[model samples]
Target: MSSYTKLRVAIEKPFGKDLSSAIELADSILGNLNSKEVFLIDHYLHKPGVSQIVEFCRSNPLLYSSAGLIDHIEIISSESIDVRGRTDYYDQYGVIRDMIQNHLTEILTLLTLDLSNLTSPSNRPFDLNAAKFDILKSIYPPFLQSAVFGQYSGYQDDLESDKGGNAHVNISTTPTLAIVVLHLQSPVWFNIPVIMVSGKKLGKRETIAKVVFKKTRHVSLRKKNGYCDDIVFTIQDSNGSSFITLPSNHNFNLPNDKTWTYNEGDGTSCSSMKTIPLGRMALKETYASVLRSLIRGESDLFVPLSNVLESWRIWSSLLLEYEEGKGEHLMIYNKSFLDNLRLTLNGSTLTVFVNSSDPQDNLVSFEKDGISFKSGNKTVEKIKEKIFGHFLYKFSRSSLAREISQDILDTAITSVQARDSFHLALPGGSSPADVYQSLVVDYKHSFPWTHTSIWQTDERCVPITSRDSNLFQLSKTLLAQVGVPYVNIHPLFPVCHKSESVLNEYASINYFDYVLLGVGKDGHTASLFPDSVNSSFSPFDNNETVKFVKLPLDYPIKVKERVTLSMERLVKARRIGMIITGKDKCHLAHVIESKDKHNSSLPFVQLLRKAKPGTVKIWMDRNICKK
Candidate 1:
C-alpha cells in the first residue's frame, strides 16, 4: 500500500485472527494509505444472491421497516463434502473463522442494515460502510451457551490420511460444523437472535438466509405454531441456482413446493423477475465480480477495516479459547446427523438437535427440557444423572473431603477428555478449605491443571493480599500447590468495576464443569447475603454472569463490598456441590429444604428451584442425618 499514492489494494479474507491483530494490521496498512485506498475483499458479498438480499428488501421496504416484528433470522451454509483437500487450512481455521466471521457476518449486515437513512445504493463507499458499521456496533458478542459444535465421525482419519499414512496425530477438537446465536443490541432489532449456522459433511450443499417473522395472531397459523411466511435468500442451491424465494401456493413455484423464486433482473416491477435456469447465471461467478469491482474502484462491495475489526471482536474470545484448547466439547456426529436434524424456534422456546456418533448407541435430540435418547447406555445414564436432577450425598466428616475431591476430579477429567479443557468455580471461606487441600494433596499429579481454568465463585472486594480475600485463601490452600498455570487461574479483581469483564469472558465458556458452593447459616451462598435483596448487591434475577455488591457501612460483615457470580450463572454449571459442614449451617440447609413457600426468598432455596432437577448434589456431614 505504501508503494503507490493512489492505488487501491484488495486485501484477502481473514484480515486477522483477533481484535488486537486486526487493529495492528489495519494500522500498518492505513498509516501508508487512506481508507479509500484500501479494499478489504470478502467475495461472498459480491455473490449476486447475497447482493440481491439488500435489493429485494430495498424494493419491498415494509420488511425492513417492520424489523421489530421479526422473530429471528437464520443464515445457513452447509456442505455435503468434508474438508479433505483443505485439511491443513481447515485445521488452522475452524468453521467459525472460515465462514461465520466473514461471509455470514457480511450477509447479516446486509440483511439487517437500516436503509431508511440512505436514499440509494448508488451512494456506495460512504453510505454502505456507515450503515454496516451501525449494525456491527449494535451487536453483542456470541455467547457459548447459544452455540453447538460438531465434528464428523471420521475427521481424525481424514486428517491422518491427508498427511502420510504413518503420520502421528492427536485427537482434533477442530469443529467442522458450528451453529452460533448472536443478539442485536439495537432497539429496532432488540433481543432477536440472529442464528448463524455453517458446517461441512452430511448435509446438502446449500447457502440461504432465512428471515422468520413473528407468529401471526391468526387462529389457523397460531394453531400450527407457524410464523409469518419466511423470506429466504437462496445464495446457492444444490443445482447452482441463486434466487430470492417468496411464499407462493401456485404449481409453478417449486418442483413440489409452494414458493416463487426471483432471480437477478433489471426491472422496477417485481413481476419482471424470473428464475434463471439451474447452473446458468452470469452473476454466479463471485470472484470475477469482486475483481471487476476492485479494478473499477467500486469500494461498495469491499469490507472496510472497521467491519473486520468488529467481526474479530465478536469472535476473538472464542478463537483464542479454542486455540488455547479451552472450548466446548466437539460432538462427534454421524453422516446422517445433519440430514435428520430439525431446528424449530417458536415463541420463546427453541428446540435444538443433538446427535451422537456412538455406533452401539444412538442419542436423539436435546430440547429445553432435557436430552432424549433412543437407547440407553449405562455410562450415558450415569452421566445424565449428574446434569439433569438433584441428588443428596451425606458423608461423615472424615469422608467429606475425600469423596468431594474425587467427584471434582472425575468431572474435571471427563470434561478435559471431551473438550480438551475443564473450567471449575470454587466458593470462598473456611468451610471447604479441607476439600481444596484434599484435591491438591491427593490428586494434584493426576489432575489436568494444564487444561483446567479455576474461577472464583465470589470474592471479597478487599485487596488480593488481604486476609478477607478469597483468592488469598484459595492460594494459601489449593492454587499455590496445584501447579496450575498462572494463565488458567482467573481471579476476581478487587476493583468491582474491573471484574465486570468476567461476564464477557464467561460468555465463551459453555459451562463450569463443576462448581463447589457453601451455604451459610443465613442461607446465603457465594457471598450473596440474604438481606441484600433489592439492594445494589442483589445478584439474583439478572442476566449478568458476574456482579458487584457493596454493603452499607453498618453491615456486620468485615468486608462490606464483594463480587459474586449471579444465581443465574451458578445454575449453568454441569454439577453443583453444596458443602455444608457446621451444625448451624447444616440445620439451615434442612430448614430451607423443608419450608416450601415460606423459604422461597432464601438464595439457597432459589438455587434449588432454578437448578436442573439432578444438577444440585448436596454433600453434608453425617450429623445432619443423625439429628
Candidate 2:
C-alpha cells in the first residue's frame, strides 16, 4: 500500500461507486509496481485463521512428518452470489476464473506445500515463480483424472450486459459451476488426489479442505437416518485441540455407541497439538499475517506464475474437450456442493453442517414444466396437475427445507394478519424430518406460535411415546424447541386403532391452513397406497373420510398399518407441501402418471388427480429429477 496511487473524488450514490470511500481504500493498494514489496495478495490471505494455520505448518515440520498429511485432499466452497454485486465481473470469468482459479487454488497450495523448503522473503530464491511448478506437474497417466461444470437453471435470466450484466444468454451451456480432481505425483502427495469444487448461486457459503489418508483400517457403524459418523485427526505444535461434537442416534438410546471412535498408533492422542479456536477471528488473523510478510518485502506467500500458467494451460485444454463433448470424465454436479453429506476426518471432508439460517429467497424460476388443470375442489375433477406441477428442484435438502420454512412462516403470518388461528397438518416419516429439524433451528423463533395450532395429517395406531409415532418426531423436532403452547397441539390416533373416530373428529373442521406431506418409495402419501380403493369399503358409504385398509402381513415397511388423512381432505388444504428426496424414489416420480386422470396404480397419482392448481407443490432434489 506504500507506493500505490489513491484516486480522490466524490460522486453521486450507487452509479458513482468508483468515487466512494471504500473504493479509495481498495485503490490505495494498487499501482505499487515500483514498491520493494516482493509479494501481493488479495484480502483472503489476510484472514487471521489462515495465517495462524499456515504459520504453524511452517514452524513445526516434525508433527507433520510423524502424523503425516492426508494422501487425498479435497476443497469445496460455494455461495449463492447475488446479481447486484459482481454481476458484470462474473459473466465472462464465471465461477471458475473468478473463484476456483484464484481463491480455491491458493487454499489448496497453502494446505499442501512443503513449508520446510520455503523461507522468509529476504532469503527466498529469485526463482520463486517455480515454487509450485513441481506440484502442478502431470503424473504418468495424467494428473487431472476428471472434471465437471454446470450452470444453474436461471443464471442468465437477469443478465442484460449493457447495464453492467454479463453477455449471458443461454444458461444451460455456460459453466457457472466447476469441480476438478488432480492426481499429484509429488513426494508429499504421491498418488494423492486433490479435488476442488466451487460454484455460484449455490445453496450457501462454505469453504474447507479435507485430507484423506488412504487405506486406514478402522471400524464404523453406519449412522442412522443416512447421516455419517465422522472423525478428525489433528497435528499441532504441542498445544491442545478440541474435536467437534458428533451426532448421536436420536431414536434409539445407547451408551456404548460413540460415533467418532478412532485409534492412534502407540496410544498417543493428538489432542495436545497447539491450535486456535475455529471461527472468524482466527481466519482474520491468518490473513493479517500474510499481509505482514508482504509489507516486510517477502514473496513467501505469493503464487508463482509458473504454477498459475500450468493451471490455465491444463484447464483450457479441458474446456476445449468439454466444448467438443469429449470430456465425459467430467462429472456434472447433481447435488449442492455446499452440502457436507459425508462422514470422515481426513482430507476429503467439507464443513459437515448446513447453515439453517441462510435466507431462502433464491427461488428464481426455471423452464416451465406446468400441469394445466381446471381449478376447483370437486372430488374427481379428475385432477393431479403434471409436467412441472409447481415443483421446485434443488440440490440441497437443507436448502429445500429452508425455502419451505419460509412458506410455512408466510402462511402463519397471513393467518396472524387476518386475525385467524393458523391450523397446520403435519406428516410422518423421515423425508420431512430434515425440514422439521431445520424449522426448529432456524425458523421456529420467527413464527407466530401463539396464533398457530398443530395437527397431524396421519399417525401410527400406538402411544405417542412410541418411536413409530409421528407425534414423537414432531414433539422432538419442533414442540420441544418452540413455545407453541401445549393446548394448540392436536394428536390423532394416540390411544388405539380407531381411524374412523379421528376422521369424524376432523370432519368438523372447515379446512387446514397449511399441510406438510411426504411421499414413500411406493409413491404413497399419508396412508394412501397403490390399489387402495376398496369396492366394499368406500369412505363415502361409511360417512367417514378416513379408512384403515388392512396391509399384507409381508409389507416392506415394518409397521403393520399406517393411519392417514384421506387424499380428498389432503387436497382441500390451502397449501399442500410434499418433499421428495433421494434417488430411489425418483423412479417412482417418473412412474407417476403426470397426465390428467390417466389413473396410475400409485396413490400419489390418485391424490394428484384431485389436487387443484396452485394448491399443491412437490419439491425434489436434482438427483430425484435425474433419470
Candidate 3:
C-alpha cells in the first residue's frame, strides 16, 4: 500500500440515515482520506443506458431542445414482486431508502446537469462531477404536499407470512411505493416537475427515465391526434443502452435518421410512425462497470459529498412527516387509486382520489404540490360540519362524565373481545378527573378490569408519590377504587427498567384501543406544549412514540420536565376521546376548529388531521358548542 502513488476508495449506497448523520459521516471520511477522491457507488449511475443520457441529450437537437423546454421529468424504477422473503431488511429500509435516495436521485442529477458548464464535450470524471455538484446546489427540497406514498394491498399479510406470524411486523407502516415530486430553484428548470417513482409489487418490472415536453403551437395541425413528443430512456428491453423517441408530427423537426419514418393522415393526425432507436453501447454489468471505474480512479460515476447532503435536505421534511405518520395518504395498489393517479399525473391535471370503499370518503382532490380534501358531493365546510357534528357530544356536567365513562367501557369490552387485552391511555387534568370518578363509581365492577391495561398519557418529572404527579392523581381517583392488577398499570415515570425497555414495550403493544385526553387552554392535548423544547423533541420529527420533554424555565407550567406519548402514537389509537370543559377551553376549541393563524402550531389540530376520520370522540359541555 505504501508503494501506491495515489488511492481512491468507493463507498456503497445509503451513506447515512439523514441529513445530520450524512454530514457527520462525510466529515469523518474526508478527514481521514488525506485529500484522496472518494467514489460513492450507485449502480444505476454506471448502467450503460443511464450513463448515456447526458450524451444522447446533448447530441440530438430534438432531445436537447426538449431538455430546455422540459415540462416534467419522470424517473421510474419499479418491481413486479413484493419483498421476496426480505422481510427484516425491506421493512426497515423501504422504497425511499433503497431506491429514490440514491439511484433515482443520481439519475436526476445526470439528466438535469448543466451541460454548458463542462469545458469540453469529453466525458471526463472531474468535469462531470463538478457540473453535477452545481445542479445539486440549486435544487430545493421536495414539497411535502406534492408527494404521494402507497403500500400494495395485502402487504401486511405478506409480511406476517414471511416472519412466520410475527404480529408486530404485521402492523408495520413502511411504504413499499412512493411518488415524490421535486423542483429546481435554478432558472433552467424552475418549478418543473421532477417526479421519481419506485415501488415493489407493481404492474411490471421495468426501469425508464422519461422527458415530457410542453405542447408547441407548431404542431397545431396535429390536433385530435393525441400525440405527444416524449423521449424515453430505458435499459429494460435491450442488451445495451437505447432510447425511444415517440414519433409526432414534428419528427421532421428532428435531425435526419434512417430509423425514423413519418406519414400524414388528412393533415389532421399522425396515422403511421416509426420509433427512432438511438445507438447502443455494449458494456459490462452495472456493478462490474462501476468497480472497474473505481479501480481506474475514475470519479465521474461517483456521487460527491455535497450532492449527498443536499439530497438529504430535499427529503428531510418528508421523512419527518412519515415519522409522525402524518404525511400523504398511503393508498393501496392495484386499486383504482394508482390507476387514476397514473392517468391524472399523465394528463393535463393532477387530481387524484384515495382508495376507499365509500365513494364519499375516497375524495382527495388537489393539483401538483399538495393534497386538499374535497367532499364527493358536499363542500369542505359541509364535510367539516358533519365531522364535528357526529363526533362532538355536548352534555351537562354530570351527563358528559357518564357518557364518557360508557364510551370507555364499550371500547374496553370490544378490545378485550378481539385481542384479549384492552390497552387504554389516560391523561391527567381537572376535566377528566370527574370522568375517571364516574368510571370507578359506575362501571368498575362490569369493566374489563382484568384484561385492561392503563397507561399514562403523560406524567410530571416529580416523584410518583408527589401530588403533582399524574400517577398520584390516578391512584387516588381510579387505581385504588378498581380491582385492576398492578402489573397492568404502565407509568411513564419511576420505571424500574431502562427507558429503552419501556419504548420496546410500547412498540410491541403497537396502539391503544382507546385514549382519553383533555385539551389545555394552549391547545395541547397531552404534555406536548405549543412551543416544544427543540427540533430533537419536535412532535413532527421525533420517531420515538414516547419522549422525555424538558420545557423551558419560562414556560407557564408547574412541572418543567415531563414524559409523554407523542402525537404519532395518539393518532394510532382505535378511538381518541377528548374532554373540553371550561369557558377558556371553549374559546380554544373554536380557534382550533376555525383553522386560524395558530392552527399550524396547535397539537390539537394536528391530531384531528392525523387521526382516522371516525375515531375521535369529543366529549364537551353544552357551552363549548354554543357558538
Candidate 4:
C-alpha cells in the first residue's frame, strides 16, 4: 500500500455567495478519507489557495495518496416566485453535485489503481483484452442479485457488434452510468470510460471521465535506475491514438516503495500521465515527441530548458528591477546587459529599468581606446561651449527638427496602419499641446484618422474640462479637430465619476503606436514626477499595457492624480518622441545625453534606457543646451 497521507481539495464557485458553501461541502466529503488532516481551498483567492493547498499537502504526508488531489466544483444559485405569489430562493447545483458525490476522488483512486497494476507485469503474456474483461466481470457480477451491472447490457453488445470485437461495454449503476471502450491490439490498452454520476439535470450531453494510458517499451532494467533508454509508448485515449517517446538518457525518477529514487543506468519507467484539457494534452504530447528528438544530450537539454528557464529568470529580474528603490540600480547597467535580458510575454505591462543618464560621458567612453567620452571638451569652458553649441545651434535647426519630427510621424503612421487599430497616449500639460496640434494638422490630410484611437498619457483628478487635465488640452488641440469618430477617443473620466473604471476601460484597448512627450526642467515627462504621489506611473513589472498613477509633487503644476501608459507600453510602441525646448531644460537634456551614470536619477534617463533600440528619438532645440 502507498504511504500517501495528505488530502487537499480545491473548490471553485460560479458565484461569490456559493464559495463558502462549496468549501463546507468539500470539507464534509474529505472527512470520509480518514486522513489526519484535510485542506479545503477556495479558488477565488488564487495565490493564497495554491499556497495553502501546497503547504497542507507538504505537511501531512501519510493520510492521503502520494499523488496530489485537486477538486473543482462550481455552484449556481437562482431565485423565483411561484404562481401562488410566494417567493423562493432555490439553490441549483451542477458540477457541485459531482464533487459532493466524490466523483473526482473515485477517478483519482481508479487512476492510482491502474498505475499500480501497470508497474508489475503478469508472467503469462497478459492478454490486455482478457485482463479488462476479467476486471469488469469481477466488479460487476451478473449473477449476484445486488450486483450493480445486473441490469446493464454487458457481453451481448460485444457479441452483436459488426466489428466482431468485444471492445465496448455500457454499465449502469445506482449513482453512475458509463460507456467503456477497450483496445486490445495496442501495447498501451486501457478502458476509456465516460461516466455521468451527478444528481442535477443532465443537460444536453453526458459529462465524461476520460482515462488514457501509454505503454513503455525498451524497458531498461538498471541497478540504480539512473536514466532510461529511449522508450516508445502507445497512447490510448477516448478521442484518438498517439505515441510518446522519452529520451534514452533523460534523467527522470519515480517514487520507490519507501522513498523517491532515481535509476542509474538504462531503465524502464512510465512518464507521468497528466490529466489536462483535451486540447492542451494533445498539444503537450505533440511537443513532447518533438522534445525527445531535440534533446541530443545533457548539454542539449540546456538549449530548450534555457529558453524555459530564461522566462522565469526574466520575471524574477523584472520583479527585482521594479522593486521599490531599485530603479536607479537597473538604469546604471550598459546596453549589452539589457539586450540579453529575457522577459515573459503575457500581454501585461513590464517594468523596465532605464538608465536615464546620458551614455556619452561615461568613464569607459572617455578613457577607453576605441571611444572618447568628450571629443570637444578638454576643460570646463570647452565643455560649456560644446553644450551651448549643440543644444543652442545644432538641435534648434529647422532641418534637423523637421527630420526627427517627420521620422516620428512616419513611424506612427506606419505602425497604426499595420495594426489596423492604434491608441495614442496624449500627455497632459502645455508641453505636448503643440505636438498634438502638429500631429492633428499633419495627419488629418495624410492619414486615415478613423482607424486611430487616442488616450491621455495622464489626467488630473479634476474634471475633463479642467485646464490641468491632459484630456482637456488634447480635446481642444487634436481630438476636437480630428475626423476620427468619438468612439475612437478614450478620455479619462474625472475622479468624481469613477476614475478606476474609466482607466481600466481605456487600458483594455491596444497600446499606443506613438506617445509624444515633452521633457520638463526637472527631467520629469508626462505626469511622471519623481518622488511624487503620481510617480506611480513607473512601468509595471508584468506585461500590462497601461498604468494609472497618483503621483504627489511639491510643484503646483506637477501635483495631480494621473494615468499614464506604462513603460512596457511605451517600449512596445512603434515610436516614441521626446520634444525638448527652452534653455531651462538644457541641464536635464545634457544629463540624459551625458555618459555619467549619476544622470540616471532623472526620469527621462530611465525612459531612454528602457526604450527598444531605434524606437525612441529625442528632439531638442539649441536653446535647451546646458552651458
In the range 470-572, model 4's lDDT, one tens digit per residue, is: 6777778777787878987777554324455664675566556777777777777765556532444443344265455665465455445655555655666
For residues 1-627, could you state the per-residue lDDT of candidate 2 as single tens digits?
Answer: 122223222111111111233234334533533223224354454443333445444444542452344445566666565443455656645555666655666665666666556564565453423545544443211111144456654555645543565464444354677666554434565435566777766666545455444444221211122212221212111222222212232122212222234222232333222223433434455556655655554444554334454545434434443454433222233235345223222332211212234323121111111111121222211112333354443433434665566567656756665656888889878888877775675445445677888888877766778888888988887788887889888777732355455556677667888889888888778877677533122353354546555467666766665566777788888887877787778676566524433557677666655777667677666456565
**C-alpha lDDT values of all predictions:** 0.69, 0.52, 0.67, 0.36
| Error in Å for residue 409 of model 1 | 32
Considering TM-score, which of the candidate structures 3 and 4 is the better prediction for this target?
3
RMSD of each: 14.6, 24.0, 19.4, 28.2
Candidate 2 lDDT score relative to the true structure: 0.52
- Model 3 lowest lDDT segment of ten: 217-226
What tens-digit string does per-residue lDDT give for candidate 3 at 1-627? 011227777788788877888899999998887434677778777665676677665555344443457667778776777885787778777788888887887888888777565346566423676677677665545433456677888888888988897787636678888877665645466546677888788766657777767763121211255344666667454235454546554443333443563444455655654454554544455678777777777666777777788778666646655655433356566633333343245432354554445667645554431244555766442112323333665554545676677677757756775798999999876878988887775556556798989998988878889898898999999999998899999887842223666666666668899999998887777887776534224331323677767777777778887777888888899899888788777676566456462346677767777788878887667666465
Q: Kindly indicate the candidate among 1 and 2 with the higher lDDT.
A: 1
A best-first ranking of the candidates according to their lDDT comes to: 1, 3, 2, 4
| Leading candidate by TM-score | 1
Q: Per-residue CA lDDT of candidate 1, range 1-627, in tens?
A: 011325888889778777888899999998988887888989887776787766665665555576666778888898888987678888878899899999998999899888675466464333777788888876655433346678888888999988875467877888988877676655466557687888888657778887776774211211122222566677887766777655432122232222444444334323323342223245447788888788777777888887788778678755654454333345777666655555556433344543324533444333222223343443332112231247655545665676677677657756875898889999789778989987775556556788989998998887788888899999999998987899898887633656345656765566898999988777788977676444466442333777778767776667877888888888989988887788666566456446353446667767877898888877777566455
Give residue 33's lDDT in candidate 2 (0 to 100): 30
Q: Which of the two, 2 or 3, has more TM-score?
A: 3
TM-score of each: 0.58, 0.40, 0.54, 0.35
lDDT of 1: 0.69
- Evaluation by lDDT, superior candidate among 2 and 4: 2
